[model samples]
Target chain A: MTTASQLTPRRQATRARLLTAAAEVFAERGFHGASVEDICEPAGFTRGAFYSNFASKDELVIELYAEHAASLRQAIAEVAAQPGLTLPDLLERVVDIWTRDPDERRRWYLLTTEFALHAVRDDDARRAWQRLQSQIRKELGALIESIAARHDLELAVPTSDLVRLLTIVLQGGLGQHLLEPRAVRAGALEREFLPLLVEATTR
Target chain B: MTTASQLTPRRQATRARLLTAAAEVFAERGFHGASVEDICEPAGFTRGAFYSNFASKDELVIELYAEHAASLRQAIAEVAAQPGLTLPDLLERVVDIWTRDPDERRRWYLLTTEFALHAVRDDDARRAWQRLQSQIRKELGALIESIAARHDLELAVPTSDLVRLLTIVLQGGLGQHLLEPRAVRAGALEREFLPLLVEATTR
Candidate 1:
């Protein structure tokens, strides 16, 4: 609930550093392996500082997921706003944004997936993560709606269903790319198949 | 490589029990937590019998993966061979097989995913798993090819790409289903979208 903008400049900087340190530590040591002290030491902040910025490691990860999701959503929205582009073009641009971040993108996904496995068994953690995810689903639904309206196409399925399929494609591509990069190049699966989905599932 | 038929009936029964026990043990305790003894205890076998059938835990998981993949492949292949079924009919049947086998299906996916997390970090483990996966890919490719040929449609992408996309859809549905069952029904994503992929990607 506390936004970075609500904090003073120094606290905001501290929070950013802690998030960065958490990303690195979590990526290397995994969710359960990385302790608060481990994350605090690298961020050059004490436990008190970490507590001030984030309530717990779970909160920190949820924020990271929100940040990652927001950046991707914003990037795609910018592309969608471009005048005269088709739905496929907008999708391709979205894939580009997804794959373009290189190291950070890979690290975020690594941390996200590692945490997802942990969260699946933990009720509070899953609920917190899902809250953010539902917001994401709504935004994506609106985006798909706008694109469909622009193209004058009546969708074969509901907007939410299409969003779910897009979600599946995105996560599917990420999972495959993470496990077998050579087999599934960064964005290759989404790029080739998502457009086909739009074409086949819409009139 | 050793088929059940190659073993004596007693050995085959032992191997099957060990596998079933491994599924339960691994599901309860993950890849590293579950010991060979734990698997053996439930199967009513000693660690010696475990070693005779599987070289190690990794081998056991790979074999489990192989078995699960083979059963699904065989089931889908049977559906494909049914006379006069269209591509959508075959796909629906495939989804049914995936969603059916309720208890075993859920357990196998849980074990497989846990092993996958472990395998992602271990090269020897990954390579062993990939060897079986590449086989699945080939089989899926041929299945897609046959269904397309049956429909007399020219595929927009290569059979292999469609297979990869389908693979993405399956895992995407699975990962979501595992994490949030109410949000993504067992076979909902694959059922609605896979046929759309086939319809749109083939001419």
Candidate 2:
């Protein structure tokens, strides 16, 4: 029998392939439209392999959800930790990740838009999404609280509301982006956005 | 032959019935899940009536979209006209319509949430949504700019961004409302939210 470490490279490659394939399938066919077979086909994997790795399509969705959240949090965390970085810098960086690449951002928007409704219908998926959102709120809230302390701002809205506000703006930008991406792409969305947040917090 | 005024009342009644039925069906079954038949059944109308009044499901959706937009603008117009009304008052009123009827808001949220994606997929629906949103932005922006002028406050963001930002927050709040109507009640949500918007408009 092959040891776990011995198969690490292969496992890593398969996982990456599966995720990439899933994202493509999910974007093109929507969450409900895509099947496990469609996702696996792109990855050159069989249903058995998919099942072995993930219990079901919902499970894969949860995993992908977690990955995207983690990636977002990580980017924010890095910016938050960067030396001498102003709030403007952090905000711009955050917006760039989502708005910089149209194709990537569109795919991300599709996933999020579909998954939100999917979670609503599926109890297990809803729980998973709720957990992910809760965690993000916690993480982001802490970051905001830290920033508030540095800036000496007393927010009228709680850090959680602030997180919700920013998240909504970013998500809603996807709707606007779907309509007029060029308009949003031209300006500094979060750059101009953070000051309002800063002002609200101070008030 | 139906005279313009004579047709107006009948049209209004039919429109009301259609909107009410559509809202109910959309709330229950989502945009894609609910069909024109679902909406027509509750309104006591046949496909002929639906088709006569509206070309397709998208047409019906656009009508509902227009109604909501008109209602919102009317609300804002009333509050905006109130002499010496503080910015906070306007914000409160804006938030109130959303939280006015908890049950109704839940239904509205579900319908509106589904509409965004549907708008993106359907051209006619997308144009309808964009038209309404543009009108909302223009009207809301004018109100915001007026308030800023009267208050002698410098908004950190432009009026368009302010309207877009508020719209997004409202959308997210509605999304939350959909998921946990009882938990995230209107009063609890509006508590700090109003101040946040008002303060953002302040210098």
Candidate 3:
């Protein structure tokens, strides 16, 4: 096996390009609609390059989810590390990160729903999907715990319950917004619901 | 055009069978995966019968949404007509109607998500979908208004906003449950969040 240092910068750049291209193709055409050739063409790479980078399209999807989860955790960590950030302020920042662009937001929602349907149909995919979900939940639980400690507030519900509630609100809110943008505006959850949840949980 | 009375009972039964079969087939095979032939085979009908009832698969999907919405309205009306139901009690009953059967729940969720992704790609479908959504929201708003009046309670938010919040919570909650059933159990939203919302909105 080649060591990380042994991989050339050019190969690393090609891998990154392939991943980005895959996200675009999958979002636009869906997993079944999109093909390996479609991803390779836009990335200016060949089938051989894509094959070398990813074992299959499913692997790329798993990687995409992993990357998204990691970035989310990083953003949460950065926000948590800030000094004296109020709960509402932290929530606003997090919501801003998640709901930046309407078009990109729709794309992400479509891709996620597609993956969810896939997970339901395939056992192996469900296992991988659940693993990522569990990781995100754990990280969110930890963040909530730390925030509660800093504010000298006791959560009215379990940390896991609170995290699950937030997850439902965020995912469900995104689906509504995508379906009816005017009615369910972006950041509606953070603006209208998150504050209520925070208030309800705090002693 | 044939008059409604002129249609035989057998004809009416066939149409109903086609609709029910269409729902099951669409949920199991998805919109694109399913065909008129597949729907007819299971319903013990022919492609001709399916065509006589629905213009196409798209039409069947639209009709399915309409039937679901109508049943939901009827349920709400029945619950509202009850003599001594408090807002919390009304909410619990509504939630119960919506969350009664896990298998049926999974099918509805899958069908809704499938239609949502379709709406993203098709403008005509989106328009049809939004019309149904608007109707549902209007009915929900009216229900909230009537409940508030009966309880002598003042809403802290706009009726529309309250409905939207509830929609986000339910839809988002369903998506989370689909992904990780163990973590987000069935009826968790009604059990935990709905009571909090009713309390928040009440005096």
Candidate 4:
């Protein structure tokens, strides 16, 4: 439960490196496909270093998602803080940042998908995932509501549902893109339709 | 390539039984977890019978998806063909049939998701899935266009995008529900919001 900031600077560096390597390995090989040794080699860390930071690969993934959410929240906040930015511009910028790293987007999507399937079948995994997601989802809902309020826009549905709608589009869009990269552009669904949806649903 | 009707009645029965068993087993254990022997026992057949029918588990899954799509299309058509049905009624009926068998719905979603992950990682699996899905999506688009036309409605986007939208919502909603059933209802997103999405996106 120790926060990353609580660790010694050297320990913090090690933790960050492990997460980076884990994300790449898991995204490519999936949750079950990649071994602990596979991830450690890329991170330039020993098994002892990995164990010192996180209990297991599962715990590392949880931390990875949390870090992703925090960074994305920060990015959106920075954009929203810009003076006199119109709602349309804010929406566009948000989408741009979200889609900025297609490689990382695919990584997060693939890894989360593998985690989600595991959560469906295992209670321990479900509890850990649900705990992380519910907290993340609540924070996201509040962030979205504040964004809408700042723009003087009223959404047609609750902010929670709006957040859920966005999640739906992200998963669906990325998955279709995964299946047919040549046909569907990465992030095209959420990028194209979300703005239109927001305009129609907001006043 | 053999159609069900092309077989003798007894062979047709055996094929149907094999499909039923495969769906149940795979849904519970996933694509990789379920063995040929596991599927055979429930179908009251031997491993020899399975090989005679399907080249592999992968081949069986492709056929499973085809049959599911075919039955669902038929169900939608039957409902659409009913006389004097209003647009709202038609929408409701469609959602009802789609959500009618929650067990089977979960089965389809879980199994297809596992297969999709495979398709993402492997080119051969990707081609097999893409071929089936492209054909299915095209027919579904045409079917949807005819439905909209019959109701004298004009969609804001192309029917193809609308079909994609429905898929995104279905996957997003179902996956969320799978993660937290106490919070989100099955088919609720597509059931409730799809109607509104359609209303706003159509004229």
Pick the DockQ winner: 4
Candidate 2 vs candidate 4: the lDDT winner is: 4
Number of the top candidate by lDDT?
4
i-RMS, each model, one decimal: 2.1, 2.1, 2.0, 1.5
lDDT digits (tens) for residues B1-203 of candidate 4 = 46778899988888889998998889778998999999998778999999988888888899999998989988998899888998889888888887889888887888888888888888988888888888888988888888888999987887777788877777777788888888778777667677777776788
With a 3 Å backbone cut-off (N, CA, C), the pairs that clash in candidate 3 are: A172-B172
Residue-by-residue lDDT tens digits, candidate 3, A1-203: 22225668987777668888998898778888999999999778899988897777777787777677678768777987899898778888888878876677677778877888888767777877887777767887888788888878898888877887787677777777777777677877556777777777668
In the range B63-98, model 2's lDDT, one tens digit per residue, is 676677667777777877789887677767777766
TM-score for candidate 2: 0.84
Q: B93, model 2: CA deviation in Å?
A: 4.0
Q: Please write out the lDDT profile of model 1 over residues A48-135, one tens digit for every residue.
A: 9889788889999988888778778877878888999977778888888888876776667667776777667678888877777788
* Regions more than 4 Å wrong, model 1: A5-10, A84-86, B1-11, B44-46
| TM-score for each of the candidates | 0.89, 0.84, 0.85, 0.90
Worst 10 residues of 1 chain B by lDDT: B101-110
> Per-residue alpha-carbon lDDT of model 2 for A4-118, expressed as tens digits?
2455787867766887899899888888789999999877899998877677787777677767777777777777778787766767777776666667667777777777877
Docking class of 1: medium
Worst 10 residues of 2 chain A by lDDT: A1-10
Name the lDDT value of residue A133 in candidate 4. 81
DockQ of 2: 0.46
In model 3, chain B matches the true chain B with a TM-score of: 0.83
Ranking by TM-score: 4, 1, 3, 2
lDDT of each residue in B87-167, candidate 1, tens digit only: 777788888998886667666666766776766667888778777778888987887788778778888887777777887
